[model samples]
Target: MKIVEKKNFKYVDYLWDEAKAATLEGNEVDLLLYRSNLLGTDLRITNYGGGNTSCRTVEKDPLTGEETGIMWIKGSGGDIGSLTRSGLAGLYVDKLRALKKVYRGIEHEDEMVALFNHCIYDLDSKAPSIDTPLHGLLPFKHIDHLHPDALIAVAAAKDSRKVTREIWGDSMGWVPWQRPGFDLGLQIEKCLAENPGIRGIVLGSHGLFTWGDTAYECYINSLEVIEMASEYIEKKIAGNGGVVFGGEKIKSLEPGKRKSQAAAIAPLLRGLCSSEKRMIGHFTDADRVLQYINSNDLERLAPMGTSCPDHFLRTKIQPLILPLEAGADLSDTTKLLGKLEPAFEQYRAEYREYYESCKHDNSPAIRDSNPVVILWPGVGMFTFAKNKQTARVASEFYVNAINVMRGAEAISEYTSLPRQEAFDIEYWLLEEAKLQRMPKEKPLSRKVALVTGATGGIGKAIADKLVEEGANVVLTDLDAELLKEAEGTYGKDEVSAVVCNVTGAADVEGAFRQACLGFGGVDIIVHSAGLAISKPLEETTEKDWQLLQDVLVKGQFLLAQSGVDIMRKQGLGGDIVSIASKNGLVAGPNNVGYGTAKAAQQHMTRLLAAELGPDKIRVNTVNPDGVIVGSKIWEGAWAEGRARAYGITVEELPAHYAKRNLLHEIIRPEDIANGVYALLGILDKSTGNTINVDGGMANAFVR
Candidate 1:
């Protein structure tokens, strides 16, 4: 981690400009956007995907069987920040253009992916970029590409043409931003034909697309255009005079708790490239405090995500508001989704209608407009995707995207492309296939995770998430009805549910045996079922302590040993995630047996990590605070009574625990679920540690 001086910043900036400028010097031009095309290939622009860059090369040589010219682009999985010459892959430009013309008789994405995968590249370092075809349609040699907020703001707005007319006027052309791929190339070609001598193009609701005769020209044009839009927005917004009055205060959520919340949110924000680290803002200022507490403006302002296109991919339209009764804290998964899923439907219906009215031709429906991302109150935005990579990417883009939109909207109304126009780009045939053809990795897909007490609150959610990732899952619980309900929830054959008393060694062993028989071999295990009995030392019984131990400590040991045995046989280290609780760290008023059992659970979690480290198995514990509020535990008035007896409202209880830390977020089942997922090699880094699931609880320190 290093910081460059403000003065030094210009040089790095100039270097990218120079690189883009240098490309056009030898009749070889790299788009100026390639210079600093995207922030990085992390959780920013393209998820775990690489951003693209290219130059037009004349393959019109008379040597052998020379055919057509090509668009050389950044290969798959390469980052845009440090793009080298070898990073770009070459594709026949004419062939790419041909893809769009045959609209009715177009190829599905899978076929095209297969075709490109076979295309010869200079080397492995250069794989085909996802946007190669889109680049081919633009005649300019140096084109700069980026999903800049300044540009996206204009794109997502309703009157892109009107907005551009007010700014650059005749100097630029406003094309409704479409999804990136071949269809967009065709659209660009058609639009270009309509207007000659256009150097810059604004894709509504997406980003800015600009090209120039030279890299410097292209770079200058991009900077000028972005600054113009951003400057205009700044000027207008300053006049609006944002929310005023004294800034509200927020309680702190601690470092360990902050990390847990980030982990909890990581899975949902898969497509958006964001790090789980942003959950550390336990102590923010007035604006954050206001936005944190009151989400009334979310629908009118940040609804369905950014007003424009790419933001839709990341933020997914809007944030789920925290219910009033939630007491400014969210602890249950159901309350979060109970509020989340309905709004999603409202947007989905509109989506279906948008496609129905202006469907140009039969395109195999746009990727399940199922809304890829979600933002929750208390918890930061959660981008939903099948994998961690997708979620992180979505979250990163969304944070900045949302911030920029909020700022820009303050100045003027946000506008964007009409529904039909947005659809064409989203379902672009060429881009769709390019992604499908990517080589698959075996480290994750096909791996199995057996989660104990998985039919319960936290365990059930974790099992569901893993199944979403295409993992083989074995769901076990002592409650047959709960497990049966879980079987219904997950769909038949996707997961196997077995009734087992984990405290009984044979029952635990039998469940493992059954899972092995069902899914071949197991690679990950999560021990989550436990008892939390809160009573005074005076009222405590020997049976109470024993009951807690039988369920919490004993269950975790038996499950981990079984997972270890199965993993060893498969010649791979397995992952073991134990769901501990906040009581483990901080003692509450009368939770004697519960607190002791939880503390013991944490020790066992660490001991397993140390023992399994030698065998390559990674073990970690997820200690969540205030999660019972959203679980069946709360439905039965257990959490409510617990909160009442403690002299606090149930709403205040989660925050009492959360405000004790740095990030003031309540622990949710999904948060605990996400932490377990991280330990299971979803991140593929670090080993042997206990990660908290509290939203920044201050003193529950574990190292």
Candidate 2:
């Protein structure tokens, strides 16, 4: 075994651990995983899920008692950095190579995907990616196909072949742009055959391919190729007086201002982009993103789109750039917002035209015409998708594109894949099939819900249920510690925590803003925050009355006002469910202050429902009589006061309340949560209505 010395590369990190490799010396698959993880650690090397790695190993054949060559490659939709053993597709090497004999041509290449299952060496291996042939057909023990930003810069340049020769001489080969499939794999094999001594190949407007006899050598070869490209690009950028993308055209807003502005416009932009289907948004004001969007060449270069298939696939063919005057003040959010609708409209129109011009007979129906990447000159970039992680990954890929553009433009004229070729890959039937194979999205998929008092039992139950149903939730409450705990309970990607005193206007507004920034705005609002003070008319003090009114009535009012404003701006009809009490309608004794507030909450739901009908915002109430289990409200003075009024011990309050209802059933927090879910998912058509979860409380029934 050759121990390759780690070179201190200026541009890319050499992260291969010799000690780690030693532990897996006999296991080529483990070595491949080690190499893959090292290469994927840096975005400069590869964006998430944008690269593939493979290693050919000898394993005992299941049928014969003989060793057979098996090739393990990164599975479809797998990210190298986080890949597990199951994420690799394992196939018989001989079986894969035999595919070449049956290959008809590029036009009929998609059929080969279905045939890949026949080549599977491991029954439980993940589905193979389109690039499987590229790895398997190559006559190397280890192979790496990467979309490093620096290498892509060289590959996407106008004179990519010339640049490749200049950078690596005859040691590297170049193949013309061909969509990844059997033919392109054949092209690479021919290129290597012609240049017998070449160490790697650069696919024009695609990416880099490097191979070695061992996994460690393969990893080194890839790093060396990318480092050389990075160094050459860096020197050229310096020679060009540090100016790239034709230099800066607009200055970036201050960091704080950029974030505030991004948060302010995210919901509206998300709504506009979501006209076809709802989209979650991710925002970034990173320096590289700012540099690209602020550049003079942004207008010319951005429209060309990304050359890498992995990039443009995630970012879309091209981003929708907001038109801003060269030196306009970006702090004027009102003015900036005015430009969004027209820009989005124009983008959609152009995208539709692009589709019409480029569609093949079997092309998948036009996907959401909305741009995945949205660029604002001074603020930064916003990327939207079905969920937060995808949105964020799209944003990251665009940043990779920006880096590629910067390097290419500095050294040579950057070029994008031709529109027709881009369309072919974007609408590839194999890609569409993979999409169709995905598990069905949950009913509340893409919906963002803001649940108040989410740390409390009812509130937490609602938040958990919403998440389970595929809605991203923002958990807000006065208890910071509990909010943090709840946030962890639900993963951060699906749940955001914000401490809010709903009665405070600033707190309410700020929480909504955070929700917009975190998950692209609120689609469902649950006013579950409340405290109870069970008191008779004689014992109820002005202080107690005021407190109940402030928390129950005023809190609901503030949350509703803010939620309504955001929902209206979104232009996506929304649901607002208030956790009111049955006492409000039943007119029970020893509940003057609390009952009045609950009545106020119930009526407010109806009023908002009537007012927001045109906007399609539904308002409803869930009235629960006695939710004792896991309820913070029941653990305190309120429970004691209610128990005293009913002439029962505090411990017996649950039985007393349950028996009081007609059906004699106990109401739990989860039951309240179910009611909220019903109003949002099942009873979506019914609004301004109250659903009592109090075991058939006849007195509380709404007329």
Candidate 3:
């Protein structure tokens, strides 16, 4: 509850001075940049994208040297913390206020948006936030509106105005809950005029607003109010045995056991929430989360909505509570599905009823009502979003909200905005319009892929192809350093790299855990890790024979079993494409070690297809031949010896083998990648089947 100056306060003060100096040195609003970052970096003050900061300043026209007052407020799509000058939209102050004189029609959210854009002083600036008018109309040099959880704990309660009075006295003004738009801005303008002495205002069920002549004054006011609210909750909830998670007495599972449990549970939740289309799920069970899910009052409190209104768009009002607890018997997978099916159906029915009751004629179209957060007794919380980044962001915000709600309920009755208010924000036209503007998704958008041996050749090609097609790809390889390098090959936003020796159980297990952590879960697996050895049967050493079998045969065995385990949990059918060599079909001279292992890999594909078919997992193979140019297996002595046997120079061996095929063309790594892409089913269905990328080898062709 205390707001003590940190040891680094002096350094922060120095930065503030520099920000002021930067403002005087020709940079527009550098002080606001420094001020926003100061608030944005502290989660206790505001979570990501949950707060806004603004300033009223004069900008001199470069051409005419005319000075005009402008209102610079946090723009849409900019995080308040780490905000820069460009992150704030600069609108002409006089022109913005002038709109009220001519604005006489029924106010619509979309129309208000257009008016805000039209008032922009600099058309090149970012789009103004929907709350631009609130900041613009306020008669102050600086303004900050933050959705701090401690303050929201007070704002979201039923008797919030009374509670806020108890903590803030008359220093803060009060405004009833109102959606952000033209009318709400006018209400605030009137409220502030009537209570001109108040230093700050708390918007019921919304957020806190503070104004001052300088950034530091408004920032300090925010801190003092937040501290008062924190103290109030602390004193009220003190020693009340608030919410206690039931698992406090349970021993923590070992790391290995914990990872396996997570891998098992993530896909099941992903499957239950998913349909034929894919949705990513991120699972976490921090100690606090486990305790909250196991709390004695969970049944009474867990069904309630978020702690504040800002989260309504990201997390639906209420979460879906699965009947099963965490650490339950996962051995009976089929039995688990049976229970989930009914629970999910009931949740859907309730969502429909809630939406139907509050929907208005002009409300934007309803989104999928499936709960975004799920509370399972043992598994903690599972958050779902269209992509991995969004799911994780929503997950963090919900976790924070849970703690805030618990604190509030422990002290007094916990409540949230009514259903109508929730529906209005959830389907608000301004937010809906943002979604409408998104471009058509790539074919594999929302899907995840894992490609093995991805540092070189066919493995790298497959990973690149998946990412290009809109899938989030996890690249795994035997070389740890190489994997790190490959991680950056694709944009960091969509690709991750992991070092996985396919032959090791721990490595394979770790790889799956990484995929789950990085992108929720995997939908497609490209198994391309292999070893090549060439020698006469009698001359093949035991080491060479063992290495080939370990990587080629045993590796596929491990990956297939693990891949199927995860895909089955997801309930969504999956595709597994293993890269096999033509040598597997047509044995080449002096290649016993490589051919035997590849042949086994090919048959393993068929066997896995048959075993996993019941779970709707498709196992298939892509047979690529004459991919000699990029492959390390065809380099150095191996290339020289193969070329000698073909009676051609090493550089000509590729051409010689390519012409020997019926099609008389070389098979490139991308060609093999294309074959793998086909089995992924973006265009057509082909599974438990083999597609040859071998330039039509007559002898190697499968009937």
The positional error of residue 133 in candidate 1, measured at the CA in angstroms, is 4.8
Point out where model 1 deviates above 4 Å: 1-52, 58-70, 75-79, 82-87, 92-134, 177-187, 190-196, 242-296, 302-309, 314-319, 322-372, 415-703
> Please, what is the whole-model Cα lDDT of each candidate in the order they appear?
0.59, 0.90, 0.77
Candidate 3 lDDT, 360-387, residue by residue in tens: 8977665676778987765567888887
Give stretches of model 2 more than 4 Å off: 1-3, 14-23, 324-338, 536-539
Off by over 4 Å in 3: 1-26, 61-65, 82-87, 104-110, 214-221, 239-259, 364-366, 488-498, 513-520, 606-616, 625-671, 692-703
- Please provide, for model 1 over 60-154, each residue's C-alpha lDDT reduced to its tens digit, 9 standing for 90 to 100: 63445675676666666565666666666766666665655544423443344444544443444365655666677787666666655666666
Clash number for model 2? 0
Clashing pairs in 3: 40-81, 245-291, 271-570, 326-378, 326-379
Task: Give per-model CA RMSD.
Answer: 18.5, 2.4, 4.2
lDDT comparison, 2 vs 3, better candidate: 2
What is the overall TM-score of model 2 with all chains considered together? 0.94
